[model samples]
Target: MKRVALLVLPALLLAGCAAKEAEPASAGLTVTGRYPLEYAEQFTIDECAGGYSLVTIGEERYLVVPEDAPLPTGLEQDLTILQQPIENIYLVSTSVMDPIISIGALDSIALSGTQADGWYLRQAREAMENGEIAYAGRYSTPDYETILNADCGLAIENTMIYHTPEVKEQLERFGIPVLVERSSYEENPLARMEWVKLYGLLLGKKEQAEQQFAEAEQRIAPLADQPSTGKTVAFFSITSNGLATVRKGNDYVARMIEMAGGDYVFADLTDNGNNLATVNLSLENFYAGAKDADVLIYNSTIEGEVDSLAALLEKCPLLADCKAVQQGNVWCTAQSLFQQSMELPDLILDMNRVFTQENPPESELKFLTKIQ
Candidate 1:
């Protein structure tokens, strides 16, 4: 019996070694499809903490581990990691700037989107004022000379600029790599936030990006579960012709309306990909559709007291009959809400405060404001 047991043990060990040899390398690591921006290429793997290889997929990178390896604490197993350090970067997208700031790599930024009075940009306004960072211009209309002459190593752009191939080629000609982040176009806010890992990779601040995303996830998940007693809401931005362009179903604002515990009245509208579409509704149609809205929030483009909400409402009598207006529920959302550098978590909290019957607790009310 002792001789048989020793023979069995050797056979078992040999089988285990054979199975290990048969397994494929790079089995558990993540690999993304081709990047939308043509300048980005494939990545190489490098050793990470705990005997794992950090996989680079263009500017978007991730960490890969053996299937048997223990998952890292406080991180989702599927999350990607950016393992390289970036230098002298310029950002052309407002949406891309927020994640970079969230990951604490704002100091590495040499140039970025314009510094408006928005909260997120305001946080970095001092840096711009002090000449530590320069405003490259609008994401869609960047000053090419400023970009070419500046000591920029990389440029982070959004998918919106895909139409401008000539401009993209010019930037590439100067040896400046362009990385496109498509999170804003994603239907889910969490999915959009997940792309923060991409920014973490470019900035070589993967750990910081992971931590920030986890915090944002924790903050937003509870709001999804919060009980609501408020009426359904719909968001509209006024057009020059006095028509209200309702937010479409899959737009980012529509997602925020859901996160704030209000049903977006236009959730049934199917034109999902249009960022800004003219709904072309008459005052009769507008009142019939949004008359019951618990809150009426409008984008306040005015910076001074001369043209207040009162003055603006007077120009559009169609909003006069709104329940929100009758009951004084009308509020002004900052134009910054439309700005890309604005963090989404902050935006969600603002929506909650605007639509909720009871005010949010102090911590939850962090970035919100009334239209007064």
Candidate 2:
């Protein structure tokens, strides 16, 4: 269960290969193929949800015409294929935004689920002001009129959208194709990064998508050789009610800590047969288990901001006695890190820097900062 173990698949390994040259055949032969998607496990190309591996380029099926958009040339009457060069998209998943940005496909996004003020990425903010990206309401309660007005060709949703099947159905009924993204389910951090390539294919920026993954892998490659420091770290947040919620052992955050040369204190805390990736504990139990951890990383995304060590202690004075607090090893991640999937490499490097004492005690960090 080492992060290094999942790094074996090189970034280029998932690049869709060119269609094989077809041999000369009888005059009446008609050839077709499906697009190949090598790495992503969440969804398949051209294959039924259960039966087959990815299909190559020419064989794609399940074509749906957008509302008022004309069908592309040469499409089979009953076959399904998205009209190429997807120009207008409604992005419901904030995490998927970074991947779309990485491939230079931001211009293609016409609608977003996040409000302008909630956007942390400057590009997303600017797009909103420029009138290029419009608010289309959240996934739970989308504005159907705005979506139809945008002439949305596609809507990329996260798994959470499943809770609102009526919303998804409504979009489809309006001629927008809805694709549910499951990248968060990937246990391996690198595999999660591989999902960028899938977005690249959809955005028609496959080359840039492959390049982004390649660069991310190159940045993480050296960490595989770093010696393990055997330090133990705890990553969690205290809820408003004082309940402690921690990531399951196999979650990407835990794997990232292990890759950065620290041992996750709760590495055995996962529910074996269930798909839950986090568990809640009483404050008393949290104090007992994490009191001796060498480092403690606050999950700011869920707990809101903890500006200082004093502030954290004020929230739960018992934490003042934890080893991490006593040794000044407490840190907090930025809220944006939770939605910025493309920053995984930087996140791992930040963890390694803290775990190995490679930087000054008060140095500013990219994704995390020392709790003052």
Off by over 4 Å in 2: 1-40, 45-81, 272-274, 358-364
Q: Backbone clashes per model, in order?
A: 3, 13
TM-score for each candidate, following the candidate numbering: 0.69, 0.81
- Give lDDT tens digits, candidate 1, residues 1-372: 000000001111111111212322233322222222211222333444344544444344344333346533333333343223445667767666667777888787777666534434664666777777787776667777776566666676765567876666666566565665655555666666767766665556778977877787777777877876455786665666666667567666677778777787767765744544335566567667788887766644323221355774665677777777777666555555444332577778767776664554445543344443
lDDT of 2 by residue, 73-165 (tens): 433333323554566788988988988998999988899999888888889989998899999999999999988777787787887787888
RMSD of 1: 12.6
Superposed by TM-score, candidate 1 places the C-alpha of residue 49 at a distance from the truth, in angstroms, of 13
Candidate 1 — what's its lDDT?
A: 0.57
List lDDT for all candidates, in order: 0.57, 0.73
| Candidate 2 least-lDDT 10 residues | 1-10
